[model samples]
Every structure is written in C-alpha cells, then in structure tokens.
Target: MTVSIWQSNLPPLREVDFLIVGAGLVGCTAAYFAAQAGRQVVITDALDVALGASSRNAGFMISSVDVYYHHAIAKYGHDVTREIWHLAKRSQALWYEFINRAGGTVKFQRTGSLLLAESEAEAEDLAQAADAMLADDLNIIHHKTDPLKRGYFAAIEQPDDGAVQPFELVHAIRQQSGVSVIPNNELYHITQHDDKFVTAYTRMFIFKARQVLLCTNAYSPRLHPYFINKVVPTRAQCLVTEPLVAPVLNTCGYSDYGYMYYRMTFDNRLLIGGGRKQNIALENDTTEDRVTDPVQQVLDNYLKRHFPDVTVPVSRRWAGIMGFTPDSLPLVGVLPDMPDVGFAVGFTGHGLSLGAGTAERAVNMMLHGTHPGALDAKRLEPAV
Candidate 1:
C-alpha cells in the first residue's frame, strides 16, 4: 500500500464512525454487524468490493477449517476444533440469511461437499476423520470406497455444505448492511490517538474513526507490522472450463488431502483449483494473484486423469491470495498498541467457510468488549 507524498496528501480529514478496512465479504459482514449494533459504519477497500479472494473462490461453503476434521483436532485440540467447526456452521447460516434476504438475486445451491482421497494413505486419514466426526454426531457420511466412481480411494460427505456466487453474495451483504463504501482507498497507516478515536491514513482521505476493524486478510501484513509473521499471503490458482453439455459434478469435490477442489458452477462449468502441493515454492508466501503455467498444467493433467469426459475448452483462469496463519485458523483481536483497532484475518483459504462468523465475533469484540476466545490472537503467543 505504498503511496507517494503527492498521492498521500489527501483532500481533507473525514470523521467516520466504525470505519472498516477492506470491502470483501468479511468487511461487508463486519459492516452489517456494526450497523446492526447501532453504529454508522463506512467500509473502505484497497480495491473494489469483493474484488479479492471473496470473488475468486470456488464458493464452497464447507464447514471446518482448511484441514480435515480429525487433523484439526490433532493440531488445535479437540475443544478448539469443535469451536471452529461451530463457527463455520454459524458462518454458513449467516450466508443463508443473506441469500434469503436478497430475494433470489444471489445464486446459491445446497450441493453439499465430498472430501475424497487420492491415495490409500489419504483414504485411511479420511476413515479416521469420519470416525471422529461421527463420534461427535456431526451428520456426515463415510464412504469406505469411492462413491463418485472417479477413481478415488475413499470419501467423507458433508451434507450441510453448499456452493454460492461469491461476488454476488458480497454485494447482497453490502446492500443489506446499508453502509457507505469507499472503494480504491488503501489504508497505509493507523494511529490510535486515544481510547475514543483512531486515526487512519489512506490514499483517499485521512479518517478520524471512532473504531476501526481490519478485514484485510492477506493484505493485513502490509498494513501493520504486528501481522508480519502472523499472516503469510499465499496465492491460489483456479481454472474453469466452458459450459458442458451436462453437469459433471453435483457437489463440491475436495481431494488429495484438501489440496485439490472442483465444483460445477450454476451455469454448468467445471471449476478446478489447488495445485499448490505440487508447486509449493511457487504458490506459497506470495501475494501475486496470477496463474502460472506449472499449477495450471497440474490442473490440466488432473482433469484429464479424473474427469476424462470433459472435453470443453478452458474458459477462464484466475488466482487469489489467501492469508495463511501459523496454526491454520483465523485471528481475531485488537492490535497491541492500538486497542481501538481490531482485526479479523488469516482464514487460511477458508474465508467463505468462516469469514461471516469471524467478522461477527470481531465486531462484537471491538464494540462490546466481548472476548473472541479460541479465535483470539493470544493463542499464537510464544510460551514464556
């Protein structure tokens, strides 16, 4: 968010109540919650609304974090894992409400999701994950073999998950939030003058805000030094084929231990993403949202190997930046020196799965002084 001295000299200092940085899905949701809390909210973004990962995702509203169920338990502990799953559930519900409130303008489908395994080892992992999920009565089906007959090893089906039009969903939320938006405004710096107000310097205007919440996600590290190591920006690429004669997949299909994901669009196009496992060096720790040949080649080979019937040409290819946290979970807390500035970030590529609920919690924590608990940034603190 580098701004030259000439560009940095904004017109005037604007006073805004509950200023939200970033106008993606989480930012819009934060605005909605803040407005609901009886505050005059204004959202500003570095780019246009929903122009980032929110618009570029496959739009799967799958529950849970980036990892598999039992794997999350091993990494974050059983209680924390359960809490995050509930958070995802809450996020999906919020999205449903937004979709319903849109009066059929937003495209959505209850297509569910299939977490498939590409190898025998992954199959065993899926079995274990299914056992843990079933023990908790999480309403999922465990298939001992590939149900899709797509040459996969095993699968775990989450009946509650769904797909959506990501870009339209953000617009719906923004309209429902009924807040003013300042697009193309990048926040370069933020300073809390006192407990009453925080001043933010942006490309457009210097804002004297009552409270500030950052939904910047992958761009968070660039905004403040506190997020330097906390959020690693990773690039994810995807390609969608032309509309097929018939729909190939009815559900979001995730395989290769969650590295690969594919789903059929509402218009009958096959969208495939995730080759980062094969090209980790090129894909990880970068904010550059441009598809490369290596990753695209992997996706191409995958399509050939799996969905051999799909002969349509590739329609479009794109990339999106995802904020990957050290623990593969979202971070919700205030900055160390600026208590008036709060942030909800680091979704680890599961922004659609957890953004709304995390934003709701972030707004509550910022405005009402409620604790975010497991989602708190304190969880990342080093042991003394």
Candidate 2:
C-alpha cells in the first residue's frame, strides 16, 4: 500500500520563481538565501533529508580547501591558490553566521584541526605551506613535535577549522528557507519552456521556474550534459566506532592532502572516512552506494594503526558519493549559452564547510547578474 511520489499529494500545476535541486547543505543554503531575496522557491531531493552526501559525510566544517595549500599551489599557482584558500575561510565564516542565526545548536564547535605529514619531505612541504598561509594572514601552526602525531612526521594545525552535525546543519538551514521541500521526488529530466524550466520528477513536478539551480553534486551530470564527465562522481566510504570514554582526536582533520580524513563526534566517537584511491578503478563511478569489502578492510587497518588502544566496536559502515572536478574547483555559473539556468556543484568533499557561502555567491550570480568570485567561472565552464 505504498503510493508513488507521482500519486502523492502535490499540486498539478505549481510554479515558483526559483526551483532548486538537491536538499543537501549547498542546495538548502541556496534556497534559504533565494527565498530571503523574495523568490518563490521550492527544493526537491531524490531521497529523504540527511540520506545523501549531506548526511553520509565525516561531519566536518573543515577550514581549508579540499586540495591542500601546497597541492593547490602546485596546480593553480600561488596567487590563485591563496585566493581560493581565503575564499574557503570566507565560506566557513558564512556557515558559522548561518548556524549562529539558528541558535548555534548544531553541535558546531571551532575545534582546530591538524593535517599530518607522513614523511620528512612532506613535513617540509607542510611547513612551507604553513608559512605561506601565515603570510596571507590566515592562522596556522606547523609543529615538528610528535606529541599529537599519530605515526606521522609532523602536523600543521589550522585553528579556524570546525565540526558540525551534518544533519543538524541542513535541518537548521531548512527552518529559515521557508521553501517547500519535496523529498523522495527526484528530478529526472528538465526542459526549457517559454523562458522557464519545466522539470519532470514524478508527473512533471507541476513546477515551473524562471531559473533552476542544479545543486545535485555527484548527480549533476546525469541531469544536464553541461557537466558530463567534468564533475566526476567519486565514491568515499566511512565507518563510525562505538562511543568511547575519550578519543585522541578532538577535532576534524585530513591527511596526505585529503586522500584520507577522520573526525571525532561530540559523543567521543571516531568517524573515519576516505581511501577511495586504494581502489581507484572501483571508486570512480557515477552511481554506486554499496560498501565494498576491500575499502572497508583498508579503513579497519587505518584505525588499528592510529588508534591502537581503542578497541571499541564499529557501529556502522556506509558509503557516500562526492563530486570532483578536473581542476579542484566546483562548477559555479549559469550555463554558458543558457543564462536561465545556473549551478554550484563539484565541491570535492570540502562542500561541508564551503557549501553555504558558495551557494550565497551562486544565488547572487543568478539573481543579481554578478559573476562568482569565490570560484572560477572560466575554468569551470562546460568542457568544450
């Protein structure tokens, strides 16, 4: 006796000034701002709240860019890298402001995080990166000491890093958006109609909007060819251990330039996720959510190597899909030729902290006709 979403209670011909896809942090935040700016808005999701990337993440408001400072500098050059990092910190600030407006009860805390270098060469690179960040007036410390080094050569602490309950963050943002949320209603296909986008998701969705924002992240390419093969849908697996008395990790962090990362929950449980590179072939796909044994084995070994004394049982194991760009930036712009539609996808796993501010900028780009500054519009354009 289950009713299809098409048969669910919905208007046959609903209209909105703005229709946003995806209900994750980015989408929700975008909807919040768009509605605040007086746009009749509605948000749709493929699944229930907190079931997608927004829920299945390490729950961190990590301060730095997904591509570390040194790695990003190597690719995008020093000045551009510095700009990206500064924008990343700005994104974190917007997120904090949003959370505070909602009474700051999202388990949000400014717990500084560390990036551990595995070798002396890597340690040197970390120190140089730290120096560059300091020159940019960003707070960071490079420690050569092994006190908090869990089998690493050295670590750099980013004092502005923080953690939050991903579910709570989205939930809090939804409260303010006032946008109609329609979950379990996936946007299968969308078409341009009379200068408005007509979306089909369970019987035409009865939705028409002057503009549509594709915040679908890993699922972006599936809806529009503009992002095909550019915004790569990557898989990341994670596991949470049973609550322990006291965990060594009190903050959110990553290692080896974000190939692996771990963070502690407020209840003193360690949640470690990553290692997609271990099975590069298997992890590079568009839509696969099943947890593989090989990746799980790698995570188990990571825990044993780092937290030897913690014999706590694993509470659960799961996987989430994230997007990565050919270059380490998200697609944040209106369609090159089609100006009526816009998007802000491909966060590369840093969207947890960067999504809110990124969405705000994207909203401005759409409504106010201003170009996005935090992200590069030229580099993120559809692959020609």
Candidate 3:
C-alpha cells in the first residue's frame, strides 16, 4: 500500500524536500525548523494532529535528567551523566525559544517542579541527587524537611522546570508556511529509490521525498519491525479534576522519582498520572483510552489523602501511550543502517520537555548531516 498526497487525491505533493512522519511534537517541530531553513516540507500523522503523547501528556517541561544525576553517574558514569544533564538543560532553553516564537495561547508556565521522596531511604537518595546536581552548579534547591502540610518527606525544587500546552504549540507550528500537514495518513513501509525515500502507507498512497523523518514515538514499532523490541510502548493513565477555588499545587510534582506525577493547571484542576508499574505487564501494549479501575482508585486515594480540604469533582479520566527505551532515555538520531532516515522517539514519558529540542536535532542532522550540540547523540545511540 502506497500513500501519497497527490496519488490519494488529497492534495498535491508541492515538491517538498522533506517528508516527516507523525505530526506530533517531534514531527511538527521538525517541519517548522525544516521550513525555516527554506526547505519545502510535508508532515503526516496516523491520527489527528497532536493526538499522540504530544497532546496526551501532563505537559510537564521538567529540566532534569531521566535518572537523577547521582543515580545516572553510578549507573552510566560521571562524564556521561553530566553530558546528559547538559543536554536536558539545553533542551529546556530550546523549548522556551519555541514557545516564544510560536506566540500562541499555549499556556506555557515556568512554575518550576518539585521532586518528593515518599520514604526515608528515598529521601536520602533524593538529597544525594540534589547535592550531586548542586555540585555541578545546577539550580536545584533542597528542602531537607517536609514542607507540605501533609508530610511529603524530602523535596527538591527545580527552578528552571516548566510546562506547556502541547496541542496548542504543535498547532501553532503547523500554521507556519511551507509545511503541509496530512492527518489520518499512516506509514506502513519505506523503500529507497534512486537517492530518494518512498513511504508507502496502508491508506493507498506513496510519498516520495529526499528524506523521511520518523517521529511516531511508541507507534513506530508498527512501521519499523525492529522497534518493537527496541522501544516498548507503555500505557499511562491520567485524570483531570474539576476546577478548585484555590490552587493546591503551585508547581508540578513527581514522587517515587518518575513513577507518579501530578500538576495543577491554571484553572486549579489537578491533573495526575502514572502507576503503570502496578500492572506493568498489562500496560506494556498499544491501546486506546481505557482507564483501569485500580489505577483510578490509586489516584483518587492520593488526592483524598493529600488534599482533604479541596473538594474537586473528577471531570475526566483517560489513558495515553508513551514509548520507553531500555536505557530509559530518548532515541534521537539517524536510524542505523538506514539511509536518509532519522527519528526522535522513545522519550520514556519525558517527551513534553525534550521533544522540541530532539526534533530540532533530528532536523539539523537530516539537513546538515551533523548532530546538534544540544542533543547528546552519543548517549542516545542504539545500544545494539
């Protein structure tokens, strides 16, 4: 099956220099940057624009390594871990630039982030992590004692952390000229032909371009068979509560390291997500918006225990899929052994913060054949 804009009777190809797959954060940002370079670009997605993790996430643009600096140093070495932290900081800066340029009602907030430790041992670990980051001159402040009236043991406030409305930002990027967006376009296969890449889709059209950038995230497994094992798709459940009078959570909060996370929106609605580890096996597959009873119960209990005074009704509950690589880092670089193919996926639930920068790196690599300094390609290289 071949899917092309012109061949499918949708719209003319218009001689695009780049054909980017998946109109989520990565694809849309890639299109914006590619088009900014005065290169004609076409972006397509399997579902509606911003329908994937790009829109389905809690919108936390946290500026920290996947694993804390202390843990990362112990696991991957000091030099590599420091490099990772630098990359994350650079990514955070790029996100601000993106939001400023897009200039939409994207609801970007730099309210910072809080990392709470649920237990004594975890508190010590978190303290060590904070100390490690501080030693490196990072602005992570530690509150040794529990600050919340409800007793969250230890916490670290990351001053540079922030949030953004992913959907609005992606839509704003799409409005840029020279970028053609094709929704409901699914890529099924890719073939190389005389210095160009032709993407065939199950929807019966063929797209030919000088290069194809795969930014499908978890959904990439279906198009690239090898990704099935390399990138594991996991389902995350989240719920939004009805507006509350006073904002209870001032900053985005995450506990148990990266396991459970929640944030308060401008409307005072609490958006909570995580706990896929409870049913890890079941959650490790592709699925639609199905919320598990146990997961919902856990989230409800957390809210009740933490915010006893606030009475907010549960307005909506939903599930989103995120991709996770074995190393718990994003995969951002040219696909090994494939020509003119680049990708930015496997964000491991941290796409909102790093998506734009990674996509920009992928676009730069595709255009100039060199990895951008902002992206730590060495750290994200395929383990195999």
Best-fitting candidate, measured by lDDT?
1
RMSD to the true structure for each prediction, in A, is 1.6, 3.6, 3.2
TM-score of each: 0.97, 0.92, 0.90
Candidate 2: deviation at residue 348, Å?
A: 0.9
For model 3, what is the C-alpha lDDT against the true structure? 0.76
Clash statistics: count for each candidate? 0, 0, 7
Per-residue lDDT over 1-384 for candidate 2, one digit per residue giving the tens place of the 0 to 100 score: 233666554647667778898888899999999999998888888885557899888877777766557666777887777767766777788778778988856778788888887678878888887777777777888888544657878888888888888889888888878776788888766666455454444444656677888889998888778787678898899998999988777767877667778888888888888777788898886578879998898889889988787799999999989998877577788765566778999888878756877898899999998878747556755387
- 228: Cα error in model 2, Å: 0.8
Put the candidates in lDDT order, highest first: 1, 2, 3
Question: For candidate 3, lDDT tens digit of each residue in 1-384?
Answer: 344565554433333468888888778878888888878788877786789888888888887667767998887778767766776776788777767877756778898998888789989999999899889888889998766756678899998898777788777767753487777877776666455555334343556667888888888777776576667888898888999888877788688777788898767898888877576777886655578888888788777866676686899998888888877767766655567778778888877766776777788888888765524445544587
What TM-score does prediction 2 earn? 0.92
Candidate 1 deviant stretches above 4 angstroms: 1-10
Residue 353's lDDT within candidate 2 is: 59
Give every collision pair in model 3. Answer: 2-204, 2-205, 2-206, 3-205, 3-206, 4-205, 4-206
Off by over 4 Å in 2: 1-11, 196-204, 380-384
- lDDT string for model 1 (1-384, tens) is 555587555658999989999999999999999999899999999888999899999899999667888888888889999999899999999999999999999999999999999999999999999999999889899999998999999999999999999999999999999997999888888888678889889877889998999999999999988998899999999999999989998899689988999999999999999999999999888998899999999999999999999999999999999999998889999998998899999999999899999999999999889999789998887766
